[model samples]
Target chain A: MAETPVRFGILGCANIARKVSRAILIAPNSTISAIGSRSLEKASKFASDNGFPASAKVYGSYDAVLDDPDVDAAYVPLPTSLHLKWAILAAEKKKHVLLEKPVALNVSELDAILQACESNGVQFMDATMWMHHPRTAKMREFLSDGNRFGKLKSINSSFTYEPGLEFLQNDIRVKPDLDALGALGDTGWYCIRAILWAVDYELPKTVTALREPEFNEAGVILSCGSSLRWEDGKVATFYCSFLTNLSMDITALGTKGNLRLHDFVIPFQENVAPFYVASNSRFVELSIGCEPSPSEHAVTTDLPQEALMVREFAGLVGAIKGRFKA
Target chain B: MAETPVRFGILGCANIARKVSRAILIAPNSTISAIGSRSLEKASKFASDNGFPASAKVYGSYDAVLDDPDVDAAYVPLPTSLHLKWAILAAEKKKHVLLEKPVALNVSELDAILQACESNGVQFMDATMWMHHPRTAKMREFLSDGNRFGKLKSINSSFTYEPGLEFLQNDIRVKPDLDALGALGDTGWYCIRAILWAVDYELPKTVTALREPEFNEAGVILSCGSSLRWEDGKVATFYCSFLTNLSMDITALGTKGNLRLHDFVIPFQENVAPFYVASNSRFVELSIGCEPSPSEHAVTTDLPQEALMVREFAGLVGAIKGRFKA
Candidate 1:
């Protein structure tokens, strides 16, 4: 018999939810079971617009979605402030949780959500979609190669976008009450994650925030940067902002090799992602030029990165469900 | 009438002198007249090895090169400590000076050299070769385009190279008594210059050195970095080291576009150079990917950057000589 698909109940009608809901629908092992909003009309419209199947239900409140017996998982696309409450409640109702990035305001709140999921025997995952991209794994292979890349020496990452004046004034991201961390939480999170991932999750010995981060009238960070150093001489720096043109870059330099990619967060093309790498580069005669220049490596994926993320999360949810039945 | 070529006297037989001597010979407006070292045999060997013209004079003492009436300009490639003495003496001797980078130990010594050059009516320039690359001018054109690049926001640069054990143990750059600034002076100079160039030579309001710079056993910095902030909210960070793979990168992000180059200090190829630029890039439907990907721009040159540097410096020297004669 074919395996059962992971049924998802989405909490809130967030702008990001539209993308993730589409991803869930595209993912082979996942399907939208229900969607809930503060207003029933809004939830109903979201379900129809997102092409949720006729069997999918619409609910007026988040509690009603969690109360549905057929909902195997809850995708929480709520604001940062409401993450701790809704995520824990969803876990308590024995539903797997897929939380949006800047998962919680702080580690303690995230820990509470993790603990609740552990006790209820449900899976939890942050929606860092890039992690699921095939290109990420290929880049990891190059970084881990001792002969090609050697020891990690330095890394620099930047993620920035210009979202316009109206969004700056009205978006929940810039509002202190809705997303206290603002640009740092939204954009800087990816930079920090990329640094950590490059170093195989080794925490830096020291992290110094670059002086005078830019802030808005509401006191939310508009732009910020930081430098991190490890005990073994590895160092990294990152900049994130909502004030500049759309740019996502990561450059990692090792003892014998270097890797660079301009569109690390969201690639310029959905079908193929490219990165440039140089190994054992040396200046030619007269120091006029490098003997071997960097070469571009493009990795293609059949499924979109977000859809791959949904599939991975649903696969884990299915395994957990199997364990519970056993 | 054809303009007379500027005649150059080299101050020392430093390793870098070989490259500059070739550049002087290749540049149509410049020629090597004489080379000097502490030992006559070493100077003779250097002049012959570097393919200097048969008319080129070889002298034992640096003063002999300065005294040579045929030498119109002096290329001082001596150690950083020796720069203050030789550059000032060269300027006083009425020879135009092309001093190697990290021109002096500090500002006071540099100021004294500048004062000598001014009083003696001699031209002085640091040997920063990449500034003369044709590609640099093309990149500048993009950066200065308001509609394309907009306002400068952030810049990150890194120039690093691993020169092997012999260099680490014996090179003048690592010796505290010779080049006290070590990697910061040798490599970091390029990074700092690149940042300033991106901002159109405007000095930063504040500069904070990143903590815990790596130091050699003789108390010379082997690796260092700093963050610079401007009053207008522009920020820049740079890292330079002698302990990593050969890499020279500059990534400058503006409000409307970004510019990136993997080899900014030296082009990866002598005949052509490239930089990447993305202007007005935006996400496609559903934020799947950027609509317009960054495009690579290649600028070709008939002469190598070093040769172009020699030509530019020689042209300035000729102009100054004409002014004095008039």
Candidate 2:
């Protein structure tokens, strides 16, 4: 028998909510049960615009969504500043919380949210959608293959895009109070996560920020980079920016091989992704060129990565509920 | 009506000379005229093994090649420690000099060689083959197009290869008295040169070496990296290694576009090389994916990059000779 599908209530009508809402609809084990916005009309329009089911309720206040008996979980896509107040409140209401990344403004806020979730027995996760992509698993296999990848040495990642003038001037990300971490929290998150992920999540021993970070008029970081060194002598460097053209890359070098991909965050297509691998590559006669072209590995997925993330979150909630019922 | 080919005398039988010798034979405007080694037997063996013309002279001493009237130029592939001595002598003897890179132990030595070439009115060129590749020109076109590439913002380059156990132990690059600059002179040179090429040879305002460079037992760097910053706010980073699998890459990010290629030093195939260009890229619907994939540009050449380098150097020498005779 299939497990019970999790019902999700959205806390706000943020722009990112539209993408998550669609993911909820597409995930087999999830459904959108409620949407709450400070303005009920905005919530209604968002639900309609995103094609929410007629059964889904629209709430004027976030409290109404948490109070709903049918809503078992909440997807909080609120501003970074509101995460501390709202995520913990959702957990206090015994609702599983799927929080947006930069999960909270700082460690204290995240700690409070985690403590509330643990006490209330509610599951909590962040919307780091790229982690759930199938391609990531395939790449991991290559990295872990000793015969192919050998000892890990270095990793470099870049995630940057030109956000244009309007976004630079008016977007909440540029505002000091709204998304204060700016490019670091927004795009650099992926670069750092990718480096950690490539090295099997082992924390770096030392982290030195690169010099000459470019900041906006409000002192929000527009571009920045850092280098991380591991206790085992492995090194990683990453750069993230909002002022350059779109470029997403992850290059992992090993003693015996290397792995590279241009689109690590989002694939060119929703279903398939490609990564290049060069194993035990050697120069041909007289060092004129290398032998054996880099092999291309394409990984396919049944659903978009975001949907996989929702399904993964709901599966956790479903397991928790099953244990509670028992 | 074709200009006479420049007669090249090989200074030593270093392994790289094998490749350059083939290139000299292939380049229509260049030919191998002599080869010098400490032993006449070794010089003769090298000439015969590399398919030198039967008439090409074999000299037991480098001075013999420098003094030979028929030798218009000397291709100095001697160990880095010997560059200052041989390159200056070649220029002093009125032979144009094609010196292998690292050029010297340091800037002061390089200045002496440059001064010798200038005072003697002999042409001087460094044998950085990739600089002459047609694909380099093609990539430059894209970078120069303001409408497509805009101002370059950042550049990241990596050049590394696992030379295996024998080379790590016996290679001149690791020897204290020879190519002691090690991986930096051997591999990092290309990374630095490529960064300079991307930005039109403008020197960076500041260059800081990355921490935690791996050194061999002989106190030679096996792997290292550095970051460069320009006055115009352009930044570049490069990594070079002798302990990693073969990997060469250049990722140049500009305001309006990006240029990336996997094989920047030596094209995977000699005849054709490919680079990916993403111009004016933007995230597509719902920020799920990007619009339009990077376009691939392929450039083909009849002769390999080294041959092109020899041809270019020969043309310059031929032009000088024409002036002298007139």
TM per candidate: 0.99, 0.98
What pairs collide in candidate 2?
none
Highest lDDT, which number? 1
Q: Which tens-of-lDDT digit does each residue in B156-237 have in candidate 2?
A: 9999999989999999999979998999999999999999999999999988777889998889999988888888777888
TM-score of 2: 0.98
Off by over 4 Å in 2: none
Question: Best candidate per DockQ, number?
Answer: 1
By DockQ thresholds, what CAPRI class is model 1?
Answer: high
| C-alpha positional error of residue A110 in candidate 1 after TM-score superposition, expressed in Å | 1.0
Error of 1 at A171 (Å): 0.6
Interface RMSD of each candidate, angstroms, one decimal: 0.9, 1.1
